[model samples]
Target: MIFYGKQSIAQSDIDAVVEVLKSDFLTQGPAIEKFEKYVAEYCGVKYAVAVTNATSALHIACLAAGLGKGDVLWTSPITFTASANCGRYCDADVDFVDIDPSTYNMSVDELEKKLQKAAVKPKVVIPVHLAGQSCDMDKIYKLSQEYGFKVIEDASHAIGADYKSAKIGCCKYSDLAVFSFHPVKIVTTGEGGMVLTNDKELHEKVLLYRSHGITRDPKMMTRTADGPWYYQQIELGFNYRMTDMQAALGYSQMQKVDEFVSRRRYLAKRYDELLKNINNIHLPDQNEDTDSSWHLYVVRVDFSKINKTKQQIFAEMKDRGICLNLHYIPVHTQPYYQKQGFKDGDFPNSEKYYEEAFTLPLYYSLTDEQQDYIVKNLVEVLQ
Candidate 1:
């Protein structure tokens, strides 16, 4: 069976993990520092803090942004729960902006409209780069300036993605950016994430919060330590540190990031060529100024031209051994968010996207033959 997305692991990745296993330090070793430095250099950022997963990265990023009670955080309604949940973790109000119909990223117009009408402005805005495509961060950054809010790029699906001629994690347009290395993402570290920033204090905050708010540095310590081994818990934090094993794997994967992106782009091009005129389906749209990592190739079904429901298409695809999936179901439509007074029609564009869109298989290791087979089956089903 084909997957919607899968990691492309090679021998080098395995060797890196094995070497870490034989080393003296299994967790919090030199490899973690090396991986962080490598990612920072790649993204052209001043700092990168490694964490256990993207969720932890987002949570710490929110905390670093000084999000708290009496403040509000906004993100796209089409994103995974972590994007909004991070704000809730900081005890702040969480809200969502509708997505752009074409890009499926946060709508800058809607953001401005919301900010303009609000009595209290947002403390932070987390614009998600959905489906591995970079959001129009230039516009979002301009909005942040006009509205006086900090920007956090929830770029979990955009590790190798490019935005306005620079890498997504460069933080050129946002105060901080996040990346994920889950098994199904562009790269895998057995579940890892990184937060990137140019702000010195924000980087330090992430470091402190990742390690239970403990600090051993004399400069950061409130008082002198009695012994060299003494450390202080200066702030409340969680143990979100990445392990040496995961770091080693991530570092190795970093070496092939460009290669992986290139392959995914090629696959997306092939899909574009082969599926151009399928009966009731529309391919993903691309921005001329940005390049996508093509993590998931989502197509929209034109229900007006089709007799079958999206639910039927998904069920039939699954029965045919093709694992079709939706990018999201509108986070505000989730039961938990509904309790927060968010309901079905709150974000119309995102809810409409949920009704029409489903992901096609797109991954580093997907072959042309498999793609063609999957497409043929899909075309036949639509026919």
Candidate 2:
């Protein structure tokens, strides 16, 4: 069966993991640092802290930004729930901005309007890089400066993407940026994530928070160490460290990121060319200043002209041995968030996008034949 997305594991990836398996350390080893350094250098960032998953990365990054019970954190409603839940984990109230209709990223215009009217402005605003295309970050950065807020980019689908010639995780316009390394992502670490930042203090805080807020450093300890083995628990943290095997695999995967992204971009262009004449669907839009990694080629079906419901199209595609998936349901529409006083109509654009959109198969290994077949089946169903 054709999956909506999947990893492309080569012999090198297997060899890297096997090497780590035969090494002295498995959990907290040299491989993790090596992987982190490679990602940092690739993204042109000063530091990168690899963690168990993107959720944990976002959690620690939020804490590093001084998010607490009384603070507010805002993100796009169209993202995975983890983007908003990170704020909830820190005891900070979470809110969402509407998405831009064209790009499906957080709307900077909506953000500025919300900030102008908010009685209590958010301490942090996370602009998610939806479908690997960046939100207008220069504008977001300007707003952050004017309104005294921090920016964290939820770049889970954007590790290989670029905005204004700079890499997504460079943290040029945000205080911190996040990347996911799930099997389905551009890079795979089995299941891992990284938080990138230019600030040394933020990096230090992230390091402390990832492993139970414990510090082995003499400078950070409250009192003198009794021995070289003595460590201090300065604050509460979690066991969010990446394993050596995972890091090694991730490092190996990073070596071929450009190739992976290039193939995906080529496939995306093919889809645009083949599907452009179809009147019943809207292809993914590109922003002038960004080059997307094309993690998921999402399309909006114009159900107004079609007689079939969204469910019918999904079933038809599945019957053809093709799997289709939605990127997200609006976060505020979830039962948990609804109970928090957010209702369906609160963010009209996000809710509207949710009703019509679903992802097509887009990944490193999707060949031209498979893509053509997928498009043929899609056109047949939509027609």
Local distance difference test scores for all models: 0.92, 0.95
lDDT tens string, model 2, 99-127? Answer: 99999999989999999999999999999
Q: Which portions of model 2 show Cα errors greater than 4 Å?
A: none
- For each candidate in turn, the TM-score is 0.98, 0.99
Cand. 1 Cα-lDDT = 0.92
Model 1 misplacement above 4 A: none
Q: Which pairs clash in model 1?
A: none
Model 2: pairs clashing at backbone N, Cα or C within 3 Å: none
**Candidate number achieving the greatest TM-score relative to the actual structure:** 2
lDDT of 1 by residue, 97-133 (tens): 8999998989888888998899989999999888889
Candidate 2: Cα lDDT at 47? 99
